[model samples]
Target: MSGIYIHIPFCKQACHYCDFHFSTNLKKKEEMVLALAKEIEMRKSEFQDEIVQTIYFGGGTPSILQIADLRFLIDEVYLNYKVVENPEITVEANPDDLTENRIIELSKNKVNRLSIGIQSFFEDDLKMMNRAHNVEEAKKCLEIATQYFDNISIDLIYGVPEMSNEKWLQDIETALSFDVPHISSYALTVEPKTALHSFIQKGIIPQPDDEVAQEHFHILVDKLSENGFIHYELSNFGKENYFSKNNSSYWLGKKYIGIGPSAHSYDGKNRGWNVSNNSLYIKSIQENKLPIEIEILTKTDRYNEYIMTGLRTIWGVSLERIEQEFGKTYLDYLNQQAAKFIEDHLLFVDDNILRTTKKGKFLSDGIASDLFLLNLE
Candidate 1:
């Protein structure tokens, strides 16, 4: 089954570390929403034979939109595609926008899942990151969201400069306190051109240390596992049957269509992304144009992509599938490259599926790259 991802590229304010395509300007909000619907219907032919199983509203901040606007966009998907009866409709929300009234209204909609961006429960961390919501809003949103939505996920940021291990643990503990079924956490990386990067360069804020991030990750895993959460993906944990169906499809290399500016789409063979500029996207889509660029995947490209995503999840790289799909030559090269990591106990093969050891889960990305085939055609 395929999925449709609609990118809402608008935010109340820009976060320090976010580099995603978005504008704080609400001037084009009405235009963009309509454009997104048009784009959804415009791309229906692409998924003519595919059934959509998930409808994900990811964004600059999807929660920033009105319930009516969101429902209108979702209805466009239904009009254009063959959607599953009970599709997992998820909205990535920010705490400030999800007031009790808002949450109650949202629960009445088709959206069944809420991925709240709590980031942290600490006031200092929230200020450091320039989050729009304060600590109380974050806590309050979760308290109310849980009452309405059973499938809720909260994001927590770790490895912030000056954030102690004690503080990080507290963040995890605080998240557990909310009883969110899923938690998606990530280390704070200073992406170039972002405020965080500028702050680090000017000595305003210290650079986020990778070593600290690694420690926090382990702590997060151990704590959540103890609380009955499964570390199903590298940056995601969910209780049984609570894994993110939309995101899991991406990692599993399933077909998905991404709508709106800066959104990406992958149809088994080709990958495409729309133009990042909002005005450009709307103009083109309105003029019966699809502002997207596409590139067909080569065998090596597909193999490398699978290796990167596969090792990051519970379902490891399948050796037998590799040989059957990519051929024995690629399989042999993978085994040859993985030898040292296996020897170091960083990776292990079980039932012919290669997965990372607990010691190596944090380093899976690096290991996956070493196994990449360069000129093996």
Candidate 2:
């Protein structure tokens, strides 16, 4: 019913498009891992149940850690918490780090899933994005990974300025050729303060075109569907029994404990996030204090959250849960707000489930926000 997320705050190199909390300096990695283990012991009773179904190693390339380091953390989880027998343990990885030996080592530690970061299968695209791995490395890793883990997911970035439609199609084809179980694709967004954003601003790199991104999006949907992959979420596609349980819990608003620096945790009612600074986080945990910020969820906060998270998935928002959690008035308000969208062929209500139509998926956030109750105060 509950899950855990551990953030690894180190990466071999920083990709220009990455805005994640990570550092290339690995001087504090050993200390940070030990600190994270201590934090887990401290926060063991945060969740009511001791049974954890999923343990996700996410963030600044979890694949960079040594096998023993990862095994030590898993041991700590077992010692401090009553982990479920068949827990889904996933590690987010980069292509270059996933050698055949490394994959075999990971498998021995009960790491059931591998989420590889293979943005593109072309050298030019990889160089343009400043990715550490090349196309050959990408293919080799996936080929080696399939031999070890059946539940493999690879990430792809679309809408890069240099990525032509033919190249994009080839990327999809290349992924399919790998026969990986899951694929998480995303548009290359230029977030503020990122090297990519600055490059675009300075005309050193062309800005991503919204039109091109949308074209790629449609292609993704069509191609993935044709390939027997379920378009389960806007950014995820998977075969039967291959959906990411760790990520699914997030969209379903399930409780999860996020450990390590810059990790976030939520328990349906309230949410908390660890500090992003590694040194500060380690220092605080060493002092037997959690470096975190907490927010208590209000009725309106819950309502709006339901809309935002639920509408993004194929499940959509449940009116029954809304009525039970937020009362009947909120449901009425949602229906009234959705009236315009329904007429515009963007949304529909069926069996008390408010879901987005095909035309609405692209603008799902905007539509969901329109139905949000902002008078939380």
Q: What CA root-mean-square deviation does each model show from the true structure? A: 0.6, 1.1
Q: Give the TM-score of candidate 2.
A: 0.98
lDDT of 1 by residue, 28-147 (tens): 999999999999989999999999999999999999999999999999999989999999999999999999999999999999999999999999999999999999999989989999
- How much is the lDDT of residue 115 in candidate 1? 96
- Highest TM-score among the candidates is held by which one? 1
TM per model?
Answer: 0.99, 0.98
**lDDT by residue (tens digit), candidate 2, 1-377:** 88999999999998999999999999999999999899988999886565888999998989899999888888888888888889999999999998889988898887899999999998888998899899888999998889888999999999999678888999999999989989999999888899988889899999898788878888888999999999888899999999999999999988999999989999888999999999999999999999999999888998898899888899999989988988888988988999999999999989989898887886788888899998845
> Which residue window of length 10 is worst by lDDT in model 2?
44-53
Model 1 residue 224 lDDT?
Answer: 96
Give candidate 1 regions above 4 Å deviation. Answer: none
Error of 1 at 141 (Å): 0.9
What are the Cα lDDT values of the candidates?
0.95, 0.90
Among all windows of 10 consecutive residues in model 1, the one with the lowest summed lDDT is 368-377
